[model samples]
Target: MSETTSKYKAPALERGLDILELLSEQDEAISKKDMVAKLGRSVNELYRMLAILEARGYITTEPESGKYRLTLKMFELSNKFPPMQRLLNAAGTEMAKLSEKTQQSCHLSVLHDAEMVVIAVQDSPYKMGFCIRLSARIDVHGSGSGFAMLAFQPEDQRRAILEASETPEPVIESVLSQMDKVRQKGYFIGASPQISGVTNISYPIFNSNRQVEAVLTMPFLTLNSDSLHHQVVSFEESRLAVADAADNLIHAIGGCTPE
Candidate 1:
């Protein structure tokens, strides 16, 4: 007689929901190892779900830090819920206006669990625009929105989120060193680490709970010009416009932005 070995099985749906729930409780983001310990699931089981979530824009991984977090697409879906429709409707108008005014792609994204998913994007009036995929997700470490979300979190919680990532320890350490400045600046501006030539600036959106629930970002290309003086002036102007629009968006959304 031949002996047989048993294989382990995981409940796919249950595991996905469990991962979301565990992440929800965290103020910062959580790492895969921490998830394994906290959720008591195997690494293979966790990686499968994480891959799905990351692909679906439900979660994002920070490239520099290799951490994962929830995204704002969650709020967009939740807006379909009867209780949230009114606020969502109101925010949509403001999002559109901001996009028009800035002449750069504008995104209204919210955090679901620990990820920031794009709920809305407004195309710029300029022929050259940053056209992002609808519901696209970017990691909390690479974009302005991620910085905004990370900045608002409590120190201990933020540290946990940073430490929880699968990123090599050295990379995490280097990124954490700059986090303090990000927190103090209230927003961030830089080129897209994921995509070449795209520059972006973003600010946090807060809910009644005073927690960062979402982010509004303006992504555009820095036009290459032979006239260095003109290029410098244009960049400065665009940055100011984006900043003003972000503040206006915060006021327009009020407490319903998310928490």
Candidate 2:
């Protein structure tokens, strides 16, 4: 059949994007009827669009409820692009400067496998702070970096991550108890449980999709002798710096960017 005469010649491209955009805006899953009503498309057309989106891994539907929501494809697509590299490149020099300024170790982390994984780090010249390893997996309930990232996650996803953390049950309960404290303070501050005399300062990084995609962590300890015992650095300054840098990076990579 001629392209213009074919019933299957619907605007597949537009419909697919529409589905993604619509799902992203919704805080909860939406029904097919609601989707068709909002998209102003016929039932058949919406069904076809939803099918294509699901097959492409861009959207998901409840097996029993038939409700739809956005999938992790958004994160996968963001990672597939080179823009994250650009963020690192743009901020690498600045990160060094920050470490030098504060005389403290600095690190960057991104959410992966529902855990906060360190992707970059700049150690302090003083050697007093914990040295973070690249690709280290941190518990969402324990580390300062993990708490910073988890604080910004969607409620359901956050709960799931915490539930699945490998941390001991008692520690998990204590961390959960302090979540409100973390949120109210806009930071997680405490002595390092894994390392003595180490302080952790961390903040989340937002992506173009406005999802908390990563975190920047700083570890430092006072160089002064008997500086009031173990003192972890506060996150106030580092959070602002990471937030600004992340905003710039997101704007740069709003769409895919070349190396």
Q: Write the per-residue lDDT of candidate 2 for residues 43-159, one digit (tens) a residue.
A: 987778788788988888889898999988886666566757766765577667777666677788877766777778778765555577766778767688888777666567666
Model 2: residue 117 alpha-carbon error in angstroms: 1.4
Residues 169-240 of candidate 1 have per-residue lDDT tens digits of 776566677677877877777778877887778777665666675677777666656743333226567667
Residue runs of model 2 more than 4 Å from their true location after superposition: 1-80, 127-129, 225-259
Model 1, runs deviating above 4 Å = 1-77, 81-87, 163-165, 224-233, 255-259
| lDDT, candidates in the order shown | 0.69, 0.69
Clashing pairs in 2: 199-232
